[model samples]
Target: MLPLSLLNTAKGHPILVELKTGAHCHPKSPTLCEYIDQRSTVDRVTYNGHLHSCDNWMNINLHEVICTSAGGDKFWRLAEVYIRGSTIKYLRLPDQIIDIVREDREFRERRETLSGNGTGRGGRGGGSGGRGGYNNNRGGRGGGGAPRGRGGFSKQQN
Candidate 1:
C-alpha cells in the first residue's frame, strides 16, 4: 500500500518537509501533490516539526517547527506553520511509523473480535441459509416449515 496514503499515522510525529521553490521565506513544507514545476536551481528549505494534520492536497499543518536553510547553517524556530501542498518537494516520515501502524491494526482487530464481527464481513459469516445451523436468515425459524418431498415439491406414487 502507499505509505503517504495513511497520513494519520504520522500525526503528532516529527516530519521533515522540504519545499520545491525554497523561496527562503520558510514556514513551508510537505504537500500531497503528484508533481512540482520548478525550473530554478533547487534550494532546500527544510521544515522540521510534528504534524498536526494534512489534507488531500498535501498541505500540512505542523507545530513547534524549526526551519533549516539549504547550507545547513541557518535555523529558525516557529510555533506553528501551514505548508502549502503546491510548494512541497517531499516529506520525511519517522522510521518507527511502521510499528505504530501495526499497533493500530491490532487494536482494531481486537475491537472487531469483541463485537463478534471477527469475519470482517460486517458480522455476516455465510450466505443464504438453506436449512440453518448458524447464519439462518430466518431468524431462528425452521426453514419456513416446508415438508420433505419425494422428488419435486409434490408427493410421488408408490
Candidate 2:
C-alpha cells in the first residue's frame, strides 16, 4: 500500500515518526538523536525542538522536537505538527491497523472471486479481440476495409 494510504489508515491512532537527520534538533551542537515524536495524528508537522508547555502536556511543532528520552520516559503532547514529507524516515503504526488492512484485502479478494472478475484483468471474451475474445472484425484498420498498400491507394488500371 502507498504511504499516504497507510497514513490515512493510521488516523486517530498513535504514531512514532523518525526523521532523516538531526538538523531539526539543537542547531549549535547537532546530535543525531532518535527523536521519536509520538503524536496522535500525522498532520501539519514541524521539526523544531522548542517545547511548548500545556497543562501536564507539551505542545510541540515538528520544528521543535528535541531528543526523545533514552529510557522512553519523556512524551511530548503535540498539538499539530507539519514535517516535510522528505524528512520522514519511517512511521510506526499501531498493530490494529494491520488487521484492518488484511481484512480489507481479504474482502476485496472474495468479492473478485464471487464476481468472476479476478484481478479486474480482461476475462473470458472481454477484451478487444486481442486475447480470449473472438475477433469480431469490429476494430483495427478502419473496420475490415481493404488493407492499405504502401502507395497510399490501389492504382486502378483501366
The model with the greatest lDDT is 1
Candidate 2 overall Cα lDDT vs. reference? 0.43
Q: List the residue pairs that clash in candidate 1.
A: 31-58, 32-58
Error of 1 at 131 (Å): 19
Clashes (N, CA, C under 3 Å) per candidate: 2, 19
State TM-scores per candidate: 0.56, 0.46
Off by over 4 Å in 1: 4-6, 22-42, 106-158
Question: Per-residue CA lDDT of candidate 1, range 15-100, in tens?
Answer: 99988764435324333111122324447778899999988888889999988766687577788888888898888888788777
- Candidate 1 TM-score to native: 0.56
Task: Report how far off residue 4 is in candidate 1 (Å).
Answer: 4.4
TM-score (C-alpha) between model 2 and the true structure: 0.46
